[model samples]
Structure formats: structure tokens, C-alpha cells
Target: MHSHPRLPPTALEDCYSDLRTDSPLDDNSMSRLGSEMRHGVTSVSNKPKSADAFFDAWIAHVNETAVYGKESIDPTRSTSYRFIWRSWCKYLASSQEGPNAPYTMANPLLAVPVDVSRFLASGMKGSKPGRAISDVTRRRYYSVLQRIYAFCASQAWMECSPLDTLAQQDIPMAEKHTGSILTPQQWDACTRRYGNPAGNTFEIRDHAILMLLFKLGLRPEEIRALRVQDFQIGIADMPTLRILPRSGPAQERTLPLDDQSAEAIQNWKRVRKDLAVVINTNKALQADFNDDRLRAASDTLFVTRSSMELAKVPLLNLVKAHIERSCSEAGLEMPVRMGPQIVRNTRLIIWLHSGLEVDAVAVMAGLKNRKGFLHLLDYCSESVKQKIQPYRRRDDDPVSVTNMLKE
Candidate 1:
């Protein structure tokens, strides 16, 4: 159907064709996927810089393909893909030997891997101002390029992403550090500062979210996946929130709502119901109504100001900002990463200190076993430490190391 199919497949393609065929992405043939990518697809007779031609095509492909329900990569990711592609184009324009020197290759398939590595290593900036971007950010950029190339390569547009040639070490694995657990008093202060009753609609929802994070130690995904029916108030002895397996590893568990959490959620539900009424009467809000987003948010527990389900980028910003503000107001030193994990970790620590069994806590937290709380072992008293001995990484585990801390 397109010109590029006549071109030869790379050596990797021959070896991995079976794997690609088995991939979920292969269900739609390139022709059936869309016509946008057909622009840069060249036969030997007509040549042009495929990167220039293919870039727009790639954007169209991403827009069309982000279709997985709930698990779908949404507009935030599509915006990011466009940003990275623009940056890549800027690098190409600067790297050419002369003004007329054609950008890299006529076929994007033959683009050099070193150039991609160099762009990442030199062109990006970190949040700390003067520094180059961190490895975690580098991995994100690497992921975007790999996704593009993998899809195009599947369609016979290119050999592989230039990034595939990079060494494993070039893009770092996720950083491994112990999750932080806050002091109980500091945790209580954070709750008071963030979760206190609020008159404002947005603040009421935020307050409810903060209470859940403090009490249940919920993952961000769990918060986003919550539905209206998941909040069981009259159905149970106490109001409870159901934590089900989402796109993450969190197992199914129904956690009883604390008095504060239950009240905050009840308040938020009132505001949420009020908003639906406002949209019908207020012509200004109704003027901008998005039927699709309204349908998506209809049963969702949490939503943005725009009446859409909360997205990944906004969720990160919301959680980070919430923790940072609460910590600052409570006069607690901020953790290096102010994300949901710290809140979850602190809640688990609270359970253990309150005399809950290590195995029981692990099951509640949906972790492998006591080893999931291995990092917290050093914080336990010797009596509590004995209970977790069977789950140690080694006989000389850190629970034993805590013994030496006092001696």
C-alpha cells in the first residue's frame, strides 16, 4: 500500500519479527492504522529528508493510537511527544555541516544513534537551574523516541530508533532509595494544615484526597481510579473506600474511612453534585461543555476544574504541591521527592508502630511479604524486629543492624 514496504528489513527485524507479530500493536496493519505516516515513506527513486516529512506523520499516529481505556496515554503525553520532536528537529538544524547540507539522511531509518545520545546528554536541562537533565528525565526522553521508532519500524518506515543502539548504562534504571516515613506528630500536623474543613469547592476535594493519602497510604493510581460507587457510606458500619487493583500492583482491599476522611469525602460529594447543577444553569460553563470529558468524569470520583478525569501530569503536580505545602505549613523539612509514596510509606509505618503484624501490614499494603517493609525494619524496636526475621534479605539483615545502632 505504501512505498517503504519494498525496502529491506534490518537484521534485528528478521530476528524479532515473531515478537513484533505477537505484540498488541500489530493488530492494526500500517495501512489500516492511518494515512498520515505515508508522507515520508520513500521509494529508491524519490528521496527527501524523512525526518522532516515523518515528524507530522508521527504526531498523527500518536493522537490516533492513544486509545486504551483508563490506561491510555492521554493529551499530556501527546503534548510531550510534540515537545520532544521539536527539540529533536532543533538539534538536526544545528548539527548539519553547512546550511545546505541535507539534515542527516534521506531515510530516517539510517539516522545515527550517537547523535541521539549526544542530544540527550548535552541539550537538556535539569530543574535545579545550571545542571544538565537527570538520568530519570533522560530515560523518559529515550522512551518517547523508542515508542516512535518501534511503531515506525513495525510499519517498515525505519530500521529501528536511533536510541536502540545506545548502551544500557546510558539511560539509567530508576533510582533506588528508601521511602521516607515522617514522625507521627509531623504527620498529624500535615493533616491539620491540608485536610482541615474548607468552604471552597476545590479545597474540599483536595482535603478529601489528603485525608485518604494520610490514612490509607493510597497510590496516585488508586486515587485516580476511584469511582462514585466505591465510597460505601451507608452500606458499611463505618464509611469505607474500596481500593481495587488499578493499572498498578495495588491489590483489592476496602479500608475503613477515618472520621476526618469520611467527613471530607462527604463534603466533597456535596460540592461535586452542586457542580453538575451549576453546569446546567450557568450558560458560561455550559458554553464550554465537552460531551466526551463529561462522560469520562460521570462516574469518576475525582475530576479536574474542567470536569474531566484527573490526568497523570496534573496528578503528579497536585500530589507534589499538596505534600510540599502541608510540610511547609507544619514546619516539617520537605522530603527530596514530595510524592504519594512518602504518604503511603508513613501510613504503613504508623500501622507497624501501632502493633500490627509485619505480615498483616504487608498484605494490607499489597506488598510481596515483610521484605516490602525491609527498609523500615531499622526503625522497629527489637521486639517488633523479631517478627520480621523470617522475611529478611539475609541473616545479617538491617533489623539486626538496628541492634548495633544502640549498642
Candidate 2:
């Protein structure tokens, strides 16, 4: 049998206590065990062959947990977690010592806390050397590893998670606010260039997307999830866009649309239909097409020129590309980054400056209450700030001091 060092006496005592109790270990107890076992000593005698099986089981378990027993999960979030885990696994395989040398994958829960810290501090492989990742990204990496370790403990794979020893200070603090909102002039320039009605099919489609994002404050996910049936037009009251609930905290709400936004949607629909028909009728591509593709194209409001479903990432890329094009055409400096959220932020700031009630703005933005919209206040324009200057009394004003002296 391969010999491994025994866990500290404190860890053994806690393990005994855990065995004596019917209740599962809480985070605090697990944290105590983690601190005690930070040296990475373990006595599990499984061979390298069994280690592979354990690794596979651990991965499967993580996938199941993340999906919440559902058939599908969010692709972006799942990919991020998997990437971070694989990076840590590689580090462990290269850095493991003693008899476990190459078998770190077999017992990943035994990773040292200091090693985890080092992995976070080190620059990612494809990134520029010495250019450390952003604090937000490091936090996400730590969060993914912490969750995995906690899961392993729950499944009896480890006595505690080594990640519990990770210090809060090690996770750098992000800036309090980093908001980007376009001015009214910038928005008009962007619309004139990329969203012009005279432009081609792609431009018209992008224009409609930008209108929905800026005018109605719809999120990218909400826009991507939109269907042809969601637009209610030629009604007794007014044309409205029904935002269906997606995978977030926002609820479903139908928003009244102005003439500009309604017209943009109508123009895009005409162009989209023409593209769909051409793709469906082409005999050369018929063999490659399937029923699912046809159904998605017909039911989904937005589609690529090739008639494929337009997912969130591609939709965002389209927005960014058009914004860049618009910036160049208008001779304006392109934003460091632009996305659907920026458009949403710009709209919210506009509403606040327009003197719209916070409650009304929140409802239009699909937020639960006015408080939810407060975070976007940082994007308020200089004009808005100047508008409030009159409310404050100047330090030199004689009325202020004279009234106080008289009293």
C-alpha cells in the first residue's frame, strides 16, 4: 500500500465529531477543517487507476449541480467554470509532490490553499505576460473553485475545502463604478450611420435591435428571446413590444412603442422575411437545412443572413460592430467597450434627466422597484448635474448668512 501522511489531530477530531452527528457540516465547521488541513496531507490510499474514476465522478457531479437537474445550462457560465477548473487541474498535475506526483487529478480536493492563491495571481496563458487578469475575473475563478470544493465535501470526497483559507484581501477590489453612457448627440450619430433606413438588410436589422435596446431599455437576453408573436401592432391603444421573461429577476412587461421604433421593426420584418424565403428556397443548401432550422427561423424574430438562430453573443457582437462603424463615420471616439447594457444605461440616464418618475422608469426598465435603478445614477450626464445647481444656495449668497445672523 502507498503510504500518505495522516491529517492533523484537529482534523481527525472534527471528522470524528462529524461522524457522531446526524446533521451535515455547515460552512463555518467546514472552514475550520479546511484551515486545519491546508498543508494538503491526506491518507486516502486509492491507486492512480481509481484516481481517474474519481476525477470523472467529480466532473459529472459538478455538471449536474450547475444544471440544477435541468437538461440544459447557460453555455457561457458553464464554459467559464470548466475553463477555471481545467486550469487548476493542470497546475495541480504539474506541482504535486511525494508519491502523488502525477495523480493530482485523482484527489483535487487535497490542493493547498497557497497553491490556489498562486494560480489566481499568475497570468493566464493566452493573455499578455505580466498582465494580470482583472479583479472581477479573479473573483469569478475563486468562486467557481470554492463551489467545487464545497460540493466535494458534501459528497464525502474531502473533509473540508482548501479554498476556505483564501483571504478576502487577495481578491482585489474593483472600482466602485465603471459606467459608459452615450450622449444624445452620439446616439443620433450612431443611429444615422448604422441604423439608417436606407441601409441594406443587415443594417436595418441591426438598427431595429439598437432601437429596442435604447428606446425600451430591453436587455440583450430579452431581445434574443423575442419571437415574431411578441410584437403587438395595429391595436386599439398603441403599438407595444412585449418583453418576455428570460432567465433573470425581471418579469414580463409590455412597453408602449413610439413611431420610430415601431417603424424600424416593420422595416426589419420585411427584410427578414425576404432573406428567410431565399434561404428556404435554395436547392443547393436544402440538404444542409433541417426542420429545426426552418422552425427557428420562422418563429424567432431575428436570424442571420444564412437563416441560423441569432444567439445572445452574436447579437452583442453585431451591436458592438455597428457602434464601431458609427463611431468612425461620425468622427467620434469609439467607446473602450460597447454592449447592449451600455445602451440600456444610456436610456436610463436619459429618463432620469427627463424628469421621469423613478417608479415609472423602473417599471419601463422591467425592474422590481425604483431602488433597483439607483445603481445607474452614476451615468447621469453633466447637463443633469448642472440642472441641480440652482437647488443649492451659493456660499457667497447674502440671504443665507443674513438669515442665520438675524436668527
Candidate 3:
């Protein structure tokens, strides 16, 4: 006698089935059965949920649903979320569950409070290396775990989320690892003044990449993700490099390129064009290029030479080679492990010491706030600060300020 509406395509089959399952017995029949089975009619306790199982589901949901067709959180964030999920899952797996042989292949979902606590404690211990997992990473994991619990609770799988009660205990805050910002003298001695080893195309490109990183303060991932189209030479007739980060819901930023950076970029672009022409001489080059993009997700502005032929580890290997060769040949201090972030930190330090307005620096560095820059500011040397004081204020000399004060 009763009727129901059709389910939407997005509705789950289980939800639809639950809606459609008809009552098998009338009230009187159910009452008779209940009377017969009264002694055995106890309620079933909620089942335990494993962090591993929950994390697997969470990542799948994030990839498939959270970022599906959404431009707000770009590919970089999506990848970061994936990494965060994977790391947490590994931690949960390594940890011991509530007194039951650590849930190895046996009812991981039955994991309770102890497993969660152990994982958090272990993660905070910095047992692995290079400073314990950051507070930001821990917070992100906590949020993900909370979402997992919420999902399980919605499905009637958990009595309550472990995270709900764990809030009372304090997770130790990580000592902010201040990144060292190279002073102008340090930067010059290391980079510009050091001079390239014979100015090959490779060296030119590497220098350009270094300039972009240190001058603009771009994230490694952001730099890696940058495409050739992202570089514009003549925007507003001023030589510029526009770094469009694929991480937020914002427009692209145009950086006013210095003469050195502009020249470096031009040199690299010419080399890249020549490289492309050589590669494309082969009839199958287009197909190879597509395959390269698919494999690496690196339609990158800066790419390794013979990048099409590289295996999975080429980028890091290329970086190592560059650092070793450049430092050895130039007689400069071997850079403290060359990576994209180091250059970015270098630029932030340069701007802060030069007395660039914090907000303006943030905008140029393409940061959402001053917080990240403030962290980088911590590494500046007092000596560098003293040297940079004269460059900080553009509009007034020391004498002018003194005369104005006298009036």
C-alpha cells in the first residue's frame, strides 16, 4: 500500500536496499517471536574499527570525492593529502592495538583507543629522523583520523571516535625548524660571484632554476609543477616570470623579473626550445612527449636533460649531480643539500633582510600569509641583518631621517 520515490544516481545501493526491505512479520507476529526469544534478545555491542581499514577508505574517498572535479584544491594539495593519508596509515599499522598482539592481520578494525595513542606518541618521538613529524603534519593526520571516525560513526560502525576523547592529552609541539637564509654576500659568493663552470646550456638552466627558486621563494612542488606556458617574457612589456601555484583558489602572480633572472630565463628558454626541436626530429616525438607527461606529471618548466629517458628517480639524481659538479668546479661551499626549498628560503631571507615590507614580500613570495615567511626569517644571521639595513628603506637616507626629526 505504501510507495517510495526513485533513488538518485548518487545514492548508495545499500541505502536503497535498506529503504526497500519490507517488514516480514506484522506487529502481532513480531511480538510472539520476541516473547519466545526474550532471553536471547540482548543488544549487540559496537564493533571495533582498525585505523588501517579506516585510512584506506579515507584516502580513496579523498581522491575520488574530495577533489573530484574541484579546482579549489589543486593537484599539489591532492598529492599532499594522499601522502599524509599514506604516512598515517603506515604509523597506525606499525603501532600496537589494545593488548591483542597489535592487530596483525586479525580484525584490524577491532583496534581501539590504545593503538591511536601509541601511533601519535611514536610519531611525536622523531624516531625516524630529521626532526619529528611536524605539528602541522600531526594536525593534518588528526583531522583525517577524525574524519575517518565520523564516517564510521555515520555508518553505525563505531560507538565513538577515539579522537573525541584524545583531545585532552597534549601532543608536543615541534620546535619550528628555522630554514637558513643566505645573506647577499653568502648568496653572491655561492651563486652569482662563484661563476658557472664554462656556461654550458645545462649550467645556464640550473642557474636559472636556482634564481627562480631563491629569488621567488617557490615551493619545490610548485616549481616542479610549473609548465612552459606559465613563463611569460613580456607581460606588460616588463620581463617577468609568473609562478602559478596549483595549490589554492586564487589567480596567478606575476613577478617583476630582475635583469639577471630575465636573462637567465631567456637563456634557458632558448635551450629548451632547441632541445625540443632536436627531440621532435624523430617522427614519434609527440607520442613520446605524451607518455612522458603521463609518467612524470612533469610538463615542468625546468626539466632534466634527456628527461624523456629517465627512470623514476631522475629528478633527485639530477639535483645531486648538479650540486656536486657546480660546487666542485666553482670553489664555492658545497650547498647544504640542494633542493627547491633551500632556494625559496634563500629568497625569503634576502627580502626580509633587505627590509621589504612583510606583506609585500608575502605577496611576491606567493604565500597566503606571513606565517611561513616568519619561520624563514628565524634563520637570518644578525651580521646579515646589519649589512642589509641600508637596503631596507627605499625612500629615505639616514641623514634625511635625522634632518626631518630635527625639524
- What tens-digit string does per-residue lDDT give for candidate 3 at 362-383? 6877776454444454465675
Reference-based lDDT, each prediction: 0.60, 0.60, 0.51
List runs of model 2 lying over 4 Å from the truth.
1-134, 137-171, 174-177, 192-194, 249-251, 276-296, 311-314, 368-377, 381-407
Q: Compare candidates 2 and 3 on lDDT and give the better one.
A: 2
Q: Tell me the deviation in Å of residue 185 in model 3.
A: 4.1
Which stretches of candidate 1 lie above 4 Å from their native place? 1-177, 235-237, 247-250, 276-296, 392-407
Give candidate 1's error at residue 3 in angstroms.
Answer: 40
> Please, what are the lDDT tens digits per residue for candidate 2 over residues 1-407?
24334333332233233232212244664465453432243222232234444444545654554321122234444555566666667555555543344433434755655556656666234235566578666766666566556545544445555555445554434323446777676777766744667688877888888888877878888887788778878667488888877744565888999888888888888887678554563443456556565555566787786655677788878778877888878888887668888788887887877877656777788876544454454565665544433332211122211132132
List candidate 3 segments past 4 Å from native: 1-173, 183-185, 193-198, 276-278, 281-300, 308-337, 380-407
Lowest summed lDDT over 10 consecutive residues: which window, candidate 2?
Answer: 393-402
Candidate topping TM-score: 2
C-alpha lDDT of residue 47 in model 3:
36
**Candidate 3 accuracy as TM-score:** 0.47
